[model samples]
Target: MSNRRDVWITGIGLVSSLGEGPEAHMQALSSGTAPVVDATGFAPYVVHPLAPISFDAQIPKKGDQRQMEPWQRIGTYAAGLALDSAGIKGNKDILGTTDMVVAAGGGERDQSVDGAILTEIESQPNPEIFLNEQLQSNLRPTLFLAQLSNLLAGNISIVHGVTGSSRTFMGEESSGTDAVRIGWSRIAAGTSEIALVGGAYNAERRDMLLLFALKRLAMHAPWAPVLAQPRGVPTGSAGAFLVLESPEHATARGAKPIAKLSGVWSERAQRNEPGAVEAVIEALINQARGDVTEGTAILSAASGAPEPTAAEVAVLARSGLPVRSITDRVGHGLEAQMPVALAIAALAVSQGSLFAPLEGEPLEKPFTETLSRAIVTGVGHWRGEGVALVERAD
Candidate 1:
């Protein structure tokens, strides 16, 4: 343990339907505010869409904004905010050395091209030949590769100057979980001094809605809280990025850390069994290597999806700690869900206060004691589960 480096959360950049920055989120959470859900736009499928933001503020270059997809722009913009929050924005010296691990889904699909192919394919005499022909003629060069998830990291590097080694993970909620896990591992192991880790999601797209709808996962909303929902609920549009650094590195730069990231654990649970996820979560919490006490709290990335959320709720029930599920406020962010939860958890611990529960679930108790520790958790709709623990800054 003596050889382990201390990992500190020095900066956080978060943007969602709730608002921008940690302060905005803090104010909203503290006030037990109503979430912004767009029921009419996507209809049947509800979305906690992003509020308006001046892209010019962060991604000032119009060309950069034009080339990147909405998710990429949101990510790049958030990366800038993280750098700024850490007092390293525009500092070429520090930015040049900062590594980044991003969790991202593939780029936006070409709906027009897709629709055209779909409409014309059935009319073709030879479906196979026509399909090939359409792919060759309709799809632009580099379109396939451009949609690769890594491009988000590339754009962040190009626009933000975070040019050190980069990696991108792509498996929904687990992707966000591992991005932070790897970033923390590197810094903790002394392989890297400082790193940026997080993800972004633009859930306002039709493609995503259709993707979820195929599995009957899309929520048609009059919009109620996650616990109140009969099943899973709305997805959200969000971007979350964090600047994590070794304690010595942060201290040398005179950057005051907001929180300490003590540990992270991730796992895949077989959904076929009744309580498999609950068992997995129990093990993950046990792996966190600390005691659950009076000052501890849980920030749940509870996907309002019934099967998993219900299991998660059961586990939280026995813990006796205050639980605040962000789903009701920010909605389920899919890939960005866990990252958003972690960012908010860091903010809550840093401020030493618990946010009022948005949904007011029966089991979610109010804590009067200042929060010193937190359990940030994620239960993926289909497969993964992860938990990370953080402590208030000393």
Candidate 2:
């Protein structure tokens, strides 16, 4: 482990309900203002809406923007921001070989078409035949193609000129953790010099809200801090990406690292089994704790789901470190949660400070000392669990 190559976070592209870019997020975090939440837009179900953005800034081509669904557009836009942040946006030499890994969910559904089919199917004499005909006639070929998870990576390659090997994962929150894990591991093992990694989520979609509501996982009350909320998630729209490079690669390119990604560990626990979630989280935290130093804090991506959040809270409480929950500020981003947590951790480490507590929650105390490192943890609402260590670069 001592001889392994060091991985550095050289660039970050983050967009959320707070805003776009590192500066915007830093400002929001420093202000200690209430997170922007929309409790009325979706009615009882609260959500953190995406801040207003002009897609033209990152994606210049109208044709390209027209073809992508909302999630793809968000991811591609963030990918462009990452390349630009690394000072390699138009530099074909670097981008031509930059490995790409993306975490994504299925594409958006055409609600109007779906509604119409459901309404007409009830009247048809032979409902099965009618449904089949409607499916073949109403759905566009492009829509199905757009639904493929890899299109986010494809769009990034087309618009940003990132032509290296591409890999896409698709298991909700777990996918995001694994994507970052793979990117950091590749650089650490000398399998790749630099990589672009992240994911995006669009919570404004009715289809997604319906899906979560079916499982009783969507919040349907007034907005509150994540820990204060009951057994459900206040989903948000966000796109987060990071550019990771081997220390030698970053130094050779004159790229300054924002933070050092020392270690990343991921696991899955049988939530049905009592204490399984807590056990896995505790083990992961202990593994990363070896790198903890003075002024270290935790940035937790604890989805507001009751079971996993309780498990995470318990483990974090025992760690005896000042902790802050990312979901409180950005809302639960599902597949984008881990990358967003990692991005914020890097931002905090680079600035040598932690953000103010959310609503002065007892668990999140004020940290007045200079922050030297951060342990970012993600406990998926249902399945995955992960921990990562990020330290200030020397």
Root-mean-square deviation of each candidate, in angstroms?
Answer: 2.0, 1.7
Clash statistics: count for each candidate: 1, 0
lDDT of 2 by residue, 267-288 (tens): 9999889999999999998888
Model 2, which residues run further than 4 Å from truth? 140-147, 291-293
Candidate 1 structure quality by residue, lDDT tens digits, 1-394: 5688889999999999988888888888898778888999988878999988888899989999999889888888888888889998988888889999999987787778888889988899999999788768886555545356888899888888898889899888999999999999999999999999999999889988998888888888778677655375589989999999998899898999989998888899989988999999977876663656868888888888888888888888777778888777898887788889999999999888888765447766778899999898889988899999999778
Residue 305 lDDT in candidate 1? 81
Q: Name the lDDT of candidate 1.
A: 0.86
Reference-based TM-score of each model: 0.95, 0.97
Displacement of the residue 116 alpha carbon in candidate 1, Å: 3.4
Top-scoring candidate (lDDT) = 2
Clashing pairs in 1: 232-304
Candidate 2 residue pairs in backbone clash: none
Error of 2 at 46 (Å): 1.1
Q: Candidate 1: how many backbone clashes? A: 1
